[model samples]
Target: MFRFLTAWIRSLSIRRIPMKIIVIGATGRVGSTVVSKLAARPDIEVYAGARHPEKVPAADNVTPFHIDLHDTKDDIKESLPEAGKLIFTAGSGGKDLLQVDLNGAVKIMKAAEEKGILRFVMLSSKGSLTPDLFSGKNPSPLANYLIAKYYADEWLMNNTHLQYTILQPTALVDKPGSGKVSLGNYTTNETSIENVAEVLIGLAEHNSSVGEIIEMSTGNEPIPEAINHLS
Candidate 1:
């Protein structure tokens, strides 16, 4: 009877363990917001990954993880902590597209796979799905950035076995979030950074939209409702 009781207690203790999630690019505007949101949950341990770990905000349940996307595959794998879910919201801002935007994202994906982190959520840009649209009459300066995102997203889908959700939000504005969003293709090309962060949080916590490429913008539906409505 004592052995049986001990076995039951061990199972209960394992069930009570908090979920660990890592947010890459935790210092960025959207990434920082994600870190703050995730940290508020008592059942989650948030690892805020950044090139400059010092920049990560101080909060309970939040730990600063040092990660340089420019590092080699082995270094990146070594740097990553063991976590169940990972959110990739880092970008190069067109400064070093090849290194930061393109290769950096790919390297992290590979490392995440190697580390056995199964769930991945990528914050991408709108129009990334249609790279050829940027060409012809008027080429946008953001063509390269979109292209990088395209391939990174493709690799996540084709090259790796990680369960991934790629979120493509339109042009981001600095407005506050309404906790509402529109999922799927929309005509408007504007979405608040706050709303994007909220959507990312929903995706991470709910584990919804796996193996899906979601295109989102500011909309009328509540964030939770919109996420739940995903098929």
Candidate 2:
């Protein structure tokens, strides 16, 4: 397994990687973080999709557009335009998880497939795990959130076509990103959004991430260097 992993990493030495990203829910928590990371990298160009397109933050190489997942098919297409890949960082309204989390995601997937984009990354909660860490004890007091995440994960997994990576992140802390992380089927207590962004960046360049579900949390390690250990 180690040999196979190392060989896989070594094979990714190709020059000129294309990175045109369409970041859905870019104004949201994880979406914003992803946008910030891409802004700092010269190799990436990000399209920020938001409900209030004009409100999307202004940053280097970032383009904001109005895109409500509930909008009409033509409306969604108009906002998405051309992009190489997509990231879903949006949240479901209240406990209507199936409405947005499941259906919204499916709609987006179909749209991307029609537009010829193959890579997709999603930001979800760690609560989605089957033997949930907090299952025995009600952690958030709102179990439905986790329930929604579970369905979202299943939908992506059971579906076909796009190469997808599901990221189930730990507690979202308010620290400036250090870019280090710890990988586990379940996380401890908390982590910063910055560190999560670092992982998203790693996935952008990682082909092995296809069909994989990774859980992350803040660790003693630095954020930027966390993914280096993945190799």
Candidate 3:
């Protein structure tokens, strides 16, 4: 009877385990929203990664994890929680592109790979897939940023063994989300920050768009329906 009781307790522990998702850049506008959305789901536990984790809002199932993208691979890996999925929403905003955008992102990818994280979701820019579109004599000022995203995205796709989803949204706006989006190659050049966060939550929950780069813009389709259509 003691052995039976032990087995039952172990099974209960297994069944009660929640899915842990680590959101890098949780202090950012998009990342913070993602953290809040994921936290509302009882089955999900969110690890909000930020340099200043204290800024992460207090919430049940939400743990603030300190992560410095500029840190070494070992240090970054040590700081990361043991999570099943990781979302890379961190960016340098062109302040220190080489260090923060390119190298910093690659470091996290390496750490995630080493940690055996199952999935990686990257928040990229819309024109990252095609560099030539923005390059030439009179290139857009965002050329450098797009280039950084391109290489980082390439590394994620080619180098990592983890299942990955790359969301590429055009110029972000602070407007309220309509809970809708258009997925594909779009030239509208405007997407709501809230919509991006909502889509990130959908991707995390459904595990859709793996191995796919989705270009997004503001649209009339519901977020869930758009995500389902992609799947």
Candidate 4:
């Protein structure tokens, strides 16, 4: 098995080895952007993972991978490739957070660990670490969403063996991103889905981003620059 793994890694090498990055939920807004951005890069093989593979975008370096979050563990395992990195962008869109956000994420993490994937970048939302930020008279959905995220984040941090980065972005807007952001604790209205995608891709490539939970908002520095600082 070790020999097969070593040879497989070696076969992917050119002047430098190309890392395979699986972006789960590739049909979503942020996930699609991440796929587009990474698709043109020569150093990475982007597997655009989604339950509906037909909905995922087509690109030169991006391949559609069918991965159903609710599938049995063995089925889900078979759908994923033996890759070195994973970026989880899957969400239940408030429909079934308990199933998708918590259970599905944990299952994927376990699969990634078993496959010997070293890095994991999760596209999480803000307020996961601080639920009080969302508690108010209206009783926001963010409160419940954060509850699921908090436990998932905790499991990844404490239980998983993979190197991880959890990005907590504020309310997601579909506007064009400034490419600038406040990459830590901050107060802001909304962050462009583009910027969040950029940050997720940046952290995946940044070797030093492991174990960091970055809560961000629109700010003054470019995505790469801001991510470098964290590294």
Top TM-score: which candidate number? 1
lDDT for 23 (candidate 4): 92
Please identify which of the two predictions, 2 or 3, would achieve the higher TM-score against the true structure.
Answer: 3
TM-score of 2: 0.81
Candidate 2, residues 1-231: lDDT per residue as tens digits? 999988877878744465788888887777888887788877888888888878677887888888777866555765686987788888765555766776677777777777777888878777675646436765555467777777667767776578888887877887887555776544457878877777876776677668878778776666445555544
Estimate, for each residue in 14-50, the C-alpha lDDT of model 4 and write its tens digit: 3676878999889888888889889889778989989
- How well does candidate 2 score on lDDT at residue 118? 81
List all candidate RMSDs to the true structure: 2.5, 8.0, 3.1, 5.6
The best-first sequence of candidates by lDDT reads: 1, 3, 4, 2
lDDT of each candidate versus the true structure: 0.89, 0.75, 0.89, 0.87
- lDDT (10s digit) by residue, model 3, range 44-101: 8999999999999999999998999989989999998999898889988889888878
Q: Model 3, which residues run further than 4 Å from truth? A: 1-16
Q: Per-candidate TM vs. native?
A: 0.92, 0.81, 0.91, 0.89
lDDT of 1 by residue, 1-231 (tens): 999999999999878689899999999988998998887888899999999999987888999989999999899999999999999999877888888888999999999999999899999988887877577877677888988888888989999999999999989999998877889877467999989998988888776699999999988899999999985
Residue 181's lDDT in candidate 2 = 70
Runs of candidate 4 with Cα error greater than 4 angstroms are: 1-14, 131-139
Query: What's the ranking of the predictions by TM-score, best on top?
Result: 1, 3, 4, 2
Better of 3 and 4 by lDDT: 3
